[model samples]
Target: MDTELLKTFLEVSRTRHFGRAAEALYLTQSAVSFRIRQLENQLGVNLFTRHRNNIRLTTAGERLLPYAENLMSIWLTAKKEVSHTSQHNELTIGASSSLWECMLSEWLVALYQQHKDLQFEARISQRKSLVKQLHERQLDLLITTESPKMDEFSSQLLGHFDLALFSAAQKTTKSELKYLRLEWGPDFQQHETGLISNDGVPVLTTSSAQIAYKLLQQLNGCSFLPVEWAKKREGIYLVPDSTTLSRPLYAIWLQNSDKQSTIKELFKTPLIAQ
Candidate 1:
C-alpha cells in the first residue's frame, strides 16, 4: 500500500471535501480521484462513495483507516531507527485555532534562529484529530485545550483563557437575562438564563468568534468567545462576571522527540492563551 495515498485518504476524511482535500494535498482533483481508484482496485475493495461533487468513505474505507495509520507509523519508525546520524530535522506541529496569536510568529523566528536545518509545517484544526495524529507519530507537537492520553506523549499545562459573552457594543440593550450566545459546554453555560442559539438558524446566526466580534461591533447581540479576544470590549461590559467562563489549555509533544532541542524550545515560550 502506498503511504501517500493513505495520507490523502486520511486528509479527505478529516476535511470531508474532495476539492478542499485536493487543494490541501496540492494534487489535481482528477489525480486524487485516480489514486483512490487505484488503491481500491489493488485492494479489491471500494473505498469511497462517488458523487459528482460530494465524497464519503465506504464501509471498507472506514475499516481500513486505522490499519493505514498504523502502517504509516511503522514506516516512519523504521526510517528513524535506521538513520545512521542526525542529518536533518523536519518537524510538523498542529494547533487549535486559539493559539494563532502573536506567539506563533515569535516561536517560528526563535526556532529558525536556533535550528537552521529545521523544516516546519503547521496546521490549525479541531482537538480530537490533532491528538490522533500526535499518537500516530505523524505530528511532532500539538497545542490544544483538551488533554489526550498516550504512553509516549507528555502533556504540559500551558495557560488559560476565559470564554466570555460578547455582543455588538452599540446594540446591547442592557438586558442581562435575555441574550443569545454560543455554547461551549455545560460547565460554562449551565443554569444561565438567557437567549442562546446557533449563529445561522435565523439566517443571521453565526458560530464564529470573529463574526461575534463583528456583530458586537455592529451591536447585533451578545456572543461567547475568549475574553482576551476582545479589543472594543474595553468599554462594553458583558452580562455580570457571574456568567464569565474560562477553560484550561495544554501543550503536548511526543516524549521520545525531546532529544531534538528545537522542538522542546517551542514549549518553553509562554503561550498567550486568549
Candidate 2:
C-alpha cells in the first residue's frame, strides 16, 4: 500500500470534501479526485458515499479508518523508537476558540523549550475537530478548555482562566448597563447577562466573543472577557457587580503514543495541577 495514498485517504475522510482536503494538502481538486480513485482501485472498495454537497464514509471506510490510522501511528512510533534525532522537532498543537483566546502563551512556550530544534504550528479548531486531528496522528498536542471524557485520552486540568464583564471606558454608572451578548458555542448560551446587573438593553449579539470584545472597545456597551485580557487594558472598567467565570484548561494527548507519555512524565506536570 502506498503511504502517500493513506495521507490522501485520511484527509478526504477528515474534510469529507475533496476540494477542502485538496486545499489543505496543497493539491488541486482534480488531483485529490485522482488520488481517491487510485486508492479505491488499489483497495477494491469505495470509501465515500457521494452526494451533491456532502460525502459520508461507507461501512468499509468506517471499519478501515481505525485500522489505517493505527497502522500510521505504529509506523510513526517505530520510526521514533530507533531514531536518534527527534522528529517532533516540528510539532503542531490544536486549540479551540476560547482556549486560543484565554490560553496562556507560557503553556506553549514551556512545551516548546523542552525540545531542541523545535518548530511549532498553532491550529485553531473546535473540540471535536481537535480530537479527530489528534487521532489521525496529525497533531502533537491539544489544548482545550473542556475536560476529556474518553478512556483513551488523558486530560490535565490547569488553573482557572478567569473572565469578567467590562463596559466602555466612557459609560459609567451601573444603574444602566446595556449589554452585548457574546456567545460562541451551544454550551455557553445560558450565561448571557451573567452576574453583572444589566439594564435590560441588549445592544448586539454575536457568535464570536472576540468580535464582541472589539465592538465593546469601540461602541457604548459591555461584554465579558478573560480577566487577564481585561486587566491588560487601561480604559475599560470592570462591571462593579460582575462575577468571575472560571474555565479550566486541559492538556490532552493520545493514549497510544509512547513518545508523548515519556515526555509527559519528564515534564512533572500533574493531571490535576492547581
Candidate 3:
C-alpha cells in the first residue's frame, strides 16, 4: 500500500477538514480529496462521513488509524537505520521536558562526547507521548520517572536527584507564601502529600520545572526545584523545615530492541555525579 495515502488520510483525520489538511500538507484541496478517495477506494470502504461543516472518521477509519501510525513510525525508523553509514550509528532518545531540563541535557553531552561515532536525535515530550512513541519503535531509549509495566520493555534505574522547596520571599510564613507546583512525577506527588497537609491550593501548577522557576523569579512565591538549580540562582532560599525530596530516574527501552547492546553500553556513562 502507498504510505502517502495513509499519510494523507491521517492529516485529514486530524484536521477534520480536507481544505485544512491540504494547507498543512502543502497540497491543493482537490489533491488532498483525491488522496482520500484513492485510499478509500483502495481499501473498499468509506473512511469518512462528510457533513455540511463537520467531518468525522467512520468505524473502519478508527480501526485503521493505529495501524497507519505504526506503519509510518516503522517506515521512518527503517529509513534512519538504512541511511546510517559506517562512520555513524543513529540513535533517538526521548524524555520528558522536565527530565531534559534537570538531567538528560548533561547526560546527552557526556554521551556524545564519549561516543563520537553516534548520531543523536533528542525528543522532549510528555510522558504519555514518549511511552506511545517507545511502543511504536519511534524511540531507541526513553528516560522517565515511571516504569513501563509492559513485558516487552525493560527498565533500569539511572540515578536519583534531589529537589527542595525554595522560596523567593526573604521571610514569609507557610500560609503567607504563594505556592507554585511543578510536577516531578507520581513518586514526588506522594512524597509531597506526606509533607504538606494544608498547604492550600497552589497559585499555579505545571509539568515544566523551568516554568515554575521563572514564575518564582518573577513573583515572590515558593516552589520545589532541583537542589542544583535552586543553589545557582540568587534570592531563592531553601524553605525552612522543608523536607528534601529524592526522586529516582529510569531508562527504558524495548527488551528485544536492535540497539539493545548500544543502549546498555551508553548507560555506563555517568549521568550524574553520585
Candidate 3 TM-score over all chains jointly: 0.86
Error of 3 at 4 (Å): 1.4
Candidate 3 global CA lDDT score:
0.83
Tens digits of per-residue lDDT for model 3, 149-209: 9999999998888888887766564556677878776666777774543754678888787
Candidates ranked by lDDT, best first?
A: 3, 2, 1
In model 2, the Cα lDDT at residue 180 comes to: 77
User: Could you tell me every candidate's TM-score relative to the true structure?
Assistant: 0.60, 0.60, 0.86
**Which regions of candidate 3 deviate over 4 angstroms?**
58-67, 70-88, 197-199
CA shift of 32, model 2, Å = 8.7
Pairs with steric clashes in candidate 1: 166-223, 167-216, 168-216, 168-219, 171-219, 180-195, 199-205, 199-206, 200-205
All candidates in order of TM-score, best leading: 3, 2, 1
Query: What ranges in model 2 sit over 4 Å off?
Result: 1-86, 110-117, 170-186, 193-210, 262-274
Query: How many clashes (backbone N, Cα, C below 3 Å) per candidate?
Result: 9, 0, 0
lDDT of 3 at 252: 96
Relative to the true structure, how large is the alpha-carbon lDDT of every model? 0.64, 0.69, 0.83
What is the model-wide C-alpha lDDT for candidate 2? 0.69
Among the numbered candidates, top TM-score falls to: 3
